[model samples]
Target: MQGFHVLVAGVEPTARQSVPQAFRVSEVVALDAAGLHLLREGDGEPRATGLAPLPCLALFATPKTLPLMREARAWIAAQAAAPVPDVVLLDRKSPPAFVERTLLENLAAANAALAGSALRQARRVARLRAEVEMLGAVRAGLDRFVGETGLAQLKRVFSTATPDFETQIELVHGAPLRQVLPVAGTGFAAIDLACTGGKRRGSFVARLTLLEDGEVLAEWRVPTPAQDGWVRLGLPVAHAGLLRTLCLVVEPASEKSPCANLALGAHQPLPAAQLGDARTGLPIAPHSLAFRLYAAVPGTTPPHSADTLMPVAARKAKPVPYALQALPAEDLARVAETDPGTGGPNLLFVADVAAILCRPGAGGRIRAACPAGARGLMASVGVHADTPSAAVGVLGVDAGAAEPALQRVPVSSGGVEEVSLLFPEPLREARDILLSAEAVDGAAEGAWVVFRDLRIYT
Candidate 1:
């Protein structure tokens, strides 16, 4: 019979000694209730180390350790990028034969499930590739006759592209936020903000104000909803002159009001914005509130009417053939929250180029506008030179509308691996791409993952 590894937690030494000889048992110290709570909340220490080649079975020998076992299972689920291990509760009085049989059955089931998932993922990737090829052929035929410019014009006319501008990252919350919009065209009307209401019961009012050059232009007050989601405040601007710059501010009625969470984007210089208490006059540099400006057509039947309201483009257009390291310093500042000691994602230099350094359970989402004719994405993942010889980890890549692609890399000290993933369809618009990493089977401190040279390819 082949030997298998089993992890035993909250099991007495005498009980652990009774594990079947066909299994290699490793003991994990049980975390107390407080410690387990903190771990679940992402504030505690890293997982217990030294058990490598991740075990096939996790056994909890006491009912008191049920919470710990559940926490472990939840952690494994959170690492959606990696393989899952089977967790079981073992009764101290259960027979030896019964325990052995149960372990084997569970191991068999887990392996079967993993195999099925892989098959499905593979089939999905194949279908996506086939569809992409078909689309490419069709586009090529059209381009031969109509030409690239004509084709683009046709797509613009037929495409149901909405002019709604919204940010992808909502990392910051609490306090009031403001956005400064640079005005160009005429017929500016209303603004719709992304807001969620709080649970406290009260007659709180949501105050939205529009200001220009230290003068209040327009203001609207609406009762704060007791529910969640976007709250649209109509800005009734009466000015007919060309407005140079407009500042939009959102806040609660009073301090006793229910706290509302307004979604905010990661800070960027353009579309100048701020978030913090307006009273203190000190802005939080991390976030800018989400807002959508609407304007009526100049020659409309009734100027500034609701029926003529169209979403105005607020954000700057992102460049094509997007490269992660090529982003501006201000944009890259919000890329990842780097803290190596706490296992957060970091930015480091790898082979004389900037790369994203991630510990286990750390990852980030990046938003990019895919250029026309873009078909796939390519990236390089590796381990730092200081990594241990036996370090191993998995990197997961997920493009919009496609199944996630996972690569398991074993770095003997320092090694680099290339990862390429094809989009499910030809991408020509903005989309969010997610990158995650996990320490599959290695020393905790040694399993650092480095990602660099990210490129969207044609």
Candidate 2:
């Protein structure tokens, strides 16, 4: 009567496994409990044959009726001496208006009481432990208190719990930790040359702060060898939170000495940024380089080609031509626009059109290499039209395979949506693959699809 139990009925499909077969609406006309056995009678009073074990029940309006809901609540009230149910599963989909309101109100009240009891119990245990430690002995008063409040039962139940209460419930409500990504490091070339003859390596500190409140989330330091000319300080910023705005404080090896000319990169496209400050002008303002945040999930296996990634400034210096034919260059480019610079500049997609066919004369295919061990590709895509039935997918091809693996993406006529495509098991070990899009429903050519920030992560 002091522990947690859930009430479930047959009508709730998801709670079916938790409910006993005897208590299902179809199996029982009346449900009564005798010790651990739930007496389920079919259209009659409980009989000896109807006795069955039921450890839990989850009550819900399964048949969409008000009477059943009331009956379930009444049964729970009648079992007040028994343990109060801790979890209530309510059907949110299409319930009687009054039943929905009543269920939510009662469920809220019960859960609030449960939470309060748990908190008080925790405080009581802590106080008893403190008293035991101070007195250096277990007191009779403590024993009596524990017996009266069922503290022993709580302890026994919690001893075997995996995560414990605080981690599972309390800490989950706390602020989330956002991951910080390493974008670029100030190589500090000339500063390294000047500090080389002194003593130690020259270092630079980069700070990330909130623009609104100026709260420092994290700071990173990159060290460069003083004698190295083309020093590339690959400093990784390992912090978490919603990050924005960066500040760099240059440090020389010696005190009271001016730092030499500092450079930011030894790599191209070294974390795009703007140098000027928008706020009040200051000395730090002259030195501060503001950059946008780029967050990427860490992956163990690198993609075969990250050559075509997001925020691409222009077509690759050596453009890999699409294995395309049939459609004229202008129409083909217009139909499936690959150059991101022409439109909204970060994503890759087929241009929006009133209608476009996917026949031999219209559709084209683009091939991209997928190295072995590649598992999946993730991308944000949107397909929209005046009507429905828009879709896209990535095709994976194996070296000796007769057929290529295809992952088709269906798109609604709404705004943009995120999509993911998983490669087949055989194709995961494949060396080459093709990514293509075509009209799924041949009759409808009005569909338009766009894909943005496509990445293949292992």
Candidate 3:
């Protein structure tokens, strides 16, 4: 029977054999006083004698053995480490059926409580590990930046540092939002916009474009911010001379939900700076968005163009294959192996490539050293042909930064689709890059999502 374990401490040989048959127990272990003493010691030596560290229920055969069980329970309680097993005294007066029913109920409750505790502990550990890694990445980034550009040369050229906002513009899909501002100085390298009301649901992409004199200077595609704060986008073009007017365009790449709001200041008619929609040719408001512009000091080099800019779609680059079979066993366990509600692998092969299977409530993660000159990640994601429900999978990559590059794709049974996401910054060293996948739909009977052909493109 599929049930929890029970420890029959100091039980007779005949009684020990009957314990498993009396009730639905996966295992019934018998132990003497010496073994009980070993358990109290907490040295884990009882495991060698076929004893589990924690059992759901413990039964004493007679009143004589009750004292030892109580002592062990007290010791465990004092330690405050493991859960104490439910103690039961098996006397001659009690009926066998009643005892059996009570034991089963207790076992179920104990098992549930233990499972919940373990899950909480695991989540805590995972969260702490992520925080530590984030801190380490921040330290590494600061060290690299300061080492390349001296600390004395780093300065903010312009900033609106205001807490009060006149109005807020809600960013939507296909609206073509633009912020026009006149530039009177050179060496501006980056822009930071104050934003609010961004709550991540599935996955969304936000594009930032810079234009001057009707010419495209640089463009960037980043994951929509999951929180409300200042969003920074680095510019790669060199501003060698004074520019007359610069236009900043912010828009959604596609029809995605849950977008951010740009904070705007009070209207000013003299500066000729305003917010408007490029499609309608009408101004939304006669105000400039709250933003900060950063620039490099004289004699210091600006951010490199090749490293910060996203590569063109038509550019030729070699793909470095990352084999799934080479992953360690522990990493493999994090992903779903068997098909949902079935024992099969739910194998799906596309172009002779094996796909990794995932289901609702189950996800996968892969960690590897960042390849030299790596610019982006490419992979194929889809649903199996026999899938019973529709699925949407969100793929993300973290290069040890506060924000991860993200992409959301709908998985269909008809055919596989490919997606490519560029990293925010190019890696200079062999830092670890983490790839993650998870289903975002609310289907209880989730479909089989498959991923294959993962590679790094330079």
Candidate 4:
């Protein structure tokens, strides 16, 4: 009863109301085909009795109907605006061989169209049902507070009372359950620059990889376009448990694209792999890389219990000695190693042409000033040659002073030794310092000296 109702077009209008209920006949139209019919719905519009050429061609078959075929072909070629019948129902008690053949040939198309239409209708019904359910829930919630039976009270409250976070949280939790911490800082340079600049539209492909324990949790290669200076991507979040580390590598789709620098958190100016000119038949590597490490916190939510007792504990902050910098071979000039394969500290010399760079504090480029209460400078040094002796110098820049100061210490070394340059007095304002090792008694040119563990402590 809820489905399509058959409208017999060939039947006379006088017999429309007389049709049996089993036919589900909604309408009847006059036509010349005495034994033919069309199964369709009457949608309150003028219905056509004559069939369109497409349906006509689909209905009749065989050389015996060649004249009728010609007439249908002419009608189709004319392209006249006309109503198309949904189905062709032969009225003959037993269809002729040709008619049966014609129905077999066109049966698949009819079934496919019917299925498609039904699917569309089903989707619309489902959407309407969801909307009605949501509205019911809203009405129930409103009724709880206003003790109202209709939507008028809900509309009045919305029109007069402004909604706020506190009110919303109270409705959700009966009380606020979380605290808000406000933080402010200038964001990433790339994001800030892109926002300030006018948008230029284009799209590129990028890939993301999430890995842990040598297993790939998730990966995606997607195309993104610049819109309003930002390209947004929705990544899968369900695999958060599998992700201990995430790395994103952005590669150019082809060889022609130019490259840009990548910044990771607070670590900017990170050197990236260089991919030379793409046209030169050289393989290019992805230069933009970002990595993050995640750690899972162990805990569980407890059932709400107002009877639980609060525990007391005490904590304090203190400064502990930390390694300022490790002067590795890569950070020094004219560096050589006695046993490079052994993976030990390499030999660095004072005669080196360039002064080795060191951070007396955390991070690069931010120079650490000697603390007013700095106890001494600590270093690890040794001689590899016979007699095992060397002279090391300390270079420092004093606060509020332009000139640099130097102190020398001679080491009669046999094995690796921990040496300290204790300040004659607390260097109240020493800013920065450098250490250089050289042969003391002219033992050899470019004397081999092992250096490591350079630190300053208060």
TM-score of each: 0.26, 0.30, 0.32, 0.26
Q: Whole-model lDDT for model 3 versus the true structure?
A: 0.53
Write one digit per residue (lDDT tens) for candidate 4, span 218-260.
Answer: 2222222222222222221112243144323333333343222
lDDT (tens digit, per residue) of candidate 1 on 1-458 = 23455656675555666666676665444444333221111235534432232444545446776666666556545544545465666666755666667677767876787799999999999999999999766644433322211111100001111222343222222455455544533544455555555455222233433444445555555455555544554433323446456666555556666544555655555434555444354565645566555443321211122222222222222222222222222222345432344543343333334466665656655544234445665566776645463344444444456665555555444567777666566666655445556555545564556766555544
For residues 129-185, could you state the per-residue lDDT of candidate 2 as single tens digits?
898787543333333333232221100000111211121100011111111223321
Question: For each predicted model, how many residue pairs clash, with residues at least 3 apart or on different chains?
Answer: 0, 10, 0, 0
Error of 4 at 36 (Å): 70
lDDT of 3 by residue, 370-445 (tens): 4555666566777753544556665665556567667777766677787766766665654343333355555435
Better of 2 and 4 by lDDT: 2
lDDT of 4 at 400: 48
Clashes of 1: 0
Identify the superior model by lDDT, candidate 1 or candidate 4.
Answer: 1
Pairs in clash, predicted candidate 2: 6-57, 7-57, 7-58, 7-59, 8-57, 8-58, 8-59, 178-240, 178-241, 392-409
Model 1 ranges off by over 4 Å: 1-177, 201-212, 236-239, 269-271, 276-282, 298-458
Score each candidate by Cα lDDT: 0.48, 0.35, 0.53, 0.33
Name every residue pair that clashes in candidate 3: none
Model 3 is weakest, by summed lDDT over 10 consecutive residues, at 317-326
Error of 3 at 297 (Å): 4.8
